[model samples]
Target: MTSYRWTMHRVYDATGNDTLGPAAISMWWLARAAAEETLQGSPLASAWLKLFRSHLSVDDPYWFRWAEDLAQSAELRRAYSGLYGRFVARALLSAHLGINRFVSLKRNGVVIPGSVAVTRISKGDIPDWIAWDDRASRHVLCEAKGSLTSRDFLAPGVPKCVKEGKAQFDRVETTGASGKLYPARWVAATRWVTDHRGGTPATLLWDPPQDHRPFSEDEAARHREAMTRAWLDSIAPGLGWRDADELLAPDRSRMAIVVNAEPGPVPPSQDWPELPDNDLPLIARLTEVARLDRFVAQRRPVPSDGPQDVADLAGAQSGSQTYQASWLPRPRGPEAKPHQGDYIAALATPFGLRPMRTRADFDLLRRAQDRARDLEEPAMIIGLPVGMDPGAAPAQTTWLDGAGISRKQDLAVFDLRRVKVDLLDSGPTG
Candidate 1:
């Protein structure tokens, strides 16, 4: 039992808020490894480590403010909030600051920076991050993506970072039982999820140019079935559980990843902190045990409880975009100008409808009616409801103005008579 504790904590207290616990600290290191390996020990990762330590070291506002602003930006929503959120944020800053020619600008500002500028500090509703190339009049937007497991990676398509991050490791499988080939993966590199418990082995991925966008789920799926089959073929090969167990024994030379020591793909570096000596042996043992169990699951016909979809847990459990989209209203079509558009519609939940409670509602309907009057082919607002009789009028009138942005008056009386309305999604277009 080598007591392998993180050695860098000696330089700075990275014990975390005491809430992260050993499990969290272990995952944090894995996240660091994921980034560093993908970047080949880039100074960016080194900087991220310093910033990350600040997050754990203290609650002081000075050290955390910038990080907090980046995390809260709407544009970095996916990259900043997920398990790999913090890591990606640091990477983005690294990328942005690396640019020598840049401007600090806000969202939708008409002025494009000098043609020589390499980066733009854009704020507001646009993409949270933009790397503009004024000379080319084109730019790449870097959106950081994070996932807890193979499923999340599968769910939203593999992000370029996640792919690169996961690809840094090798999970080799035996081509044949007697052959020295066996599948091994740096499983730790991909499962940096902070929000949920279970994680899947990241599907091995690659980006030769390192300038690719996030890959879709379909793209990843294209390789999954075939790869999964091949992996099973290499390790299981119809061998009984007992025989397969023997094949995966600890002394086997094929498995390169050991828990306590630097596993295959994870290079030992002075730049990075070390895992505790005691933790290494234990990590190694567990990794081996998991390796054996997973190997058997594939060799044997029984399922491996089929990893629960992280998304499923997300819906029943709540964490950022990790929840289910249940019972949501259908999106209303974009508002069209009253002059060119023909139909206006409103959704009237029996109780959600109420008479214009204030002045704003009344003005909205009046303006809409005025706009409708000017149109060549007059459009009527239709009120739709559930279980309503044909030709039945709505109790209250609710419709956006002709501009389609404002909610107008209580035309309850007109809704019952002149307005051709029904409690259905069918608007004029419908």
Candidate 2:
């Protein structure tokens, strides 16, 4: 396995007082973003994935030579750096701030027709992406910039990018369903010092304080619905779906399968064990039983119909629409069972069986499902492998001020690593 690391520096206000924080990036998420966000259904998706993997610090020597060859060309280096920068920025924002749903302003009308309201403002100098913060009930505007220059040269250019990003943020405005303008948070994320051999990869986040604005419940609902649809649009083509409409078809149900595996060779289909019987029913009805608030919190696509039985799959008549399928990879080694693989599947209607490793995995899915059904809130299930002590929470960093008194903030620094991937290789089948 090849491990990659980076530091996240959060700048406070325009003065740029940097505080280090803990952030993580998943290789699976990056691959998905490369296909859906960067290429956006272009024919170059596979080629881009191959190039991206080569840029990483892989175990293979050939990939290192390939990266060196690409870096020799200034134009290719810049293009690779810029595209990868946006990918890292998106992953960081999602992991640190829970800003998962992103809409590209450049494809505003095509992706989500008439969703954003930018009438009075000119289209020039707009931010790259507009995302909704479900936790804070507000909108966020971000401009992403990347550079492959040395640290000394990159430092001087960051402030210039920040100034330009802030200008772009000022030009866009969006109102919610209540006809009230949602509070906006502006961020300029720049990926500087990208060469790992010379220095660690880092992202300088410039977030400036803005005027306080009120947000209404109606507006939150509107944004969540629109953004959920937008998220589907972004992921559908990459998953081999015809379009977002097919996943969101009112007559059919949808399922999102999250598979957790150790970092190594891809496991075979027969290695997938059967799911526990007790947990099967809840997994089938996750979306149908989902509370409005919980659904809004997750912002995933929903199905219009009610729950059905998994047994019906056996005798179902031909030409009947049943369920849709897609999967996500969460490659991590469980402490207890290091070699085993697990699955967490979410469905809008009843679906057939699949394999999961342990009872704890089922319990985690149950809690998440119950939260959607009863608590009306989203669950955080992206911690380390289950059935093992997670240890103490990450320690908060502290520093002394000029007055000699110490001040502390919630910040945890950590590393992110993953195994290499071959995009052309076939994944496990049913």
Candidate 3:
């Protein structure tokens, strides 16, 4: 560490999110990777991304049943290693980078198609972000913490990630401006967690060992040098400190810094914000952080526009475009239109789902779930066929696949925007 100048910049997120700390920072990285799309004509722009999904997930019930029993008595480990990382990482990365993704680190750098973040530092490591820039042929290392020039610190639970900042200054050396002055350095623990927006950014001139008087520049230099060595030796001995600068520059691949990366899709939304999201990555990530009950309770995808279930078939359209499906038990007559109020409604767009004849629609004879969220106590008169046997065994469901014909679900839940209201079938199939 020679005579160096530290540069820090303050930027606001597009969503006005303040807590851009660890989990927020980390998850945003994942979200961007999840969102990026490969160009069609630009061969170089096409980078393959492989989405890795862990078997151990937050959505699984079996794990929590015996999570406490997961012994670490011997050469063993906690059951939630991957899960903790997933939750923290996902939470951190997206913590700050909301819909706009406004925090651009470098204006010009190589855009690695499937670039990877290397050596994930702990909650407070100086270099948490170490990723390669395939385009610039370099590796950018970033040590990010919120600005600490605050007159007051955070209240307990005011900013959740602030508790994790305790480790940032521990075992780290400090310096003062002169031998005559007391040594001082900005400590994350004492400062308020840098969330959303706050005081203007100010440069801190670190000082040496404590005293009442100020020291000369020469004294500050000596303190900085001695403390720098101690800082490196104690905190980041393995950081390859010597070649850090080289890796941070373009054409620095000559330095040995290798990160394993996998191939994945380049979504159209990556290029066009207005485009629809594939959300495969988000679905995979939430598997780690989602509550088990959420899956069972909703029993469906929450993001209305996300990937549709195979059983869902053709999902709802932006407009009220008519759709057709090879429905089960077949329609008895021609059109079965009930009162408008009889339909299971949605908040955004009214979901139109019905014509379910049996359990064969979703596998089981009795689970033909036609129950409404609120069935008006009795049931809305939805024009049931005459002589209908509610106790009759459900018909076997057969999934019919086609782009030529659109498919609609037999039922609709809360997400109206994503619902595929199965309406009247084509005529003359008696």
TM-score of each: 0.22, 0.53, 0.21
Clashes of 3: 37
Span of 10 residues, lowest total lDDT, candidate 1:
8-17
Q: Would you list the rank order by lDDT, best first?
A: 2, 1, 3
Could you give the candidate ranking by TM-score, starting with the highest?
Answer: 2, 1, 3
* Candidate 3 wrong stretches, greater than 4 Å: 1-52, 55-173, 176-430
Each model's number of backbone clashes? 31, 2, 37
Q: Candidate 2: worst 10 consecutive residues by lDDT?
A: 400-409
Choose the strongest candidate by lDDT: 2
Q: TM-score of model 2 relative to the true fold?
A: 0.53
- Candidate 2 vs candidate 3, TM-score winner: 2
Q: In lDDT terms, how accurate is model 3? A: 0.21
Residues 1-430 of candidate 2 have per-residue lDDT tens digits of: 1222323333333223222221234443444344345324333333543465455543321111123424678876776666666766675565444554676666332234434453226556677777766656556676677765534212322356677777776666665444536334445354444234443334555666555454477645665666656655664444334555754454221122223323233232111222346644542343233221211111223345732211111111121011110111222332332122111221111111212223443444454446444743322121111111111211122121110111111111111112111111124322
Candidate 3 local lDDT, 1-430, one digit each (tens): 0001111111111122111110101122332222211100111111111111222122221111111212235222222322222222222222211111111122221121222212222333432222211111222232223322343222112232232333432322222222111112111211211213232111111111122233355443343333222222221112222322321333322221111111112232221122025533433343322222111112345445443222111121111011111111111121122211112111110121222232232222012223322331111111111221212211222111110001121111111111122322221111
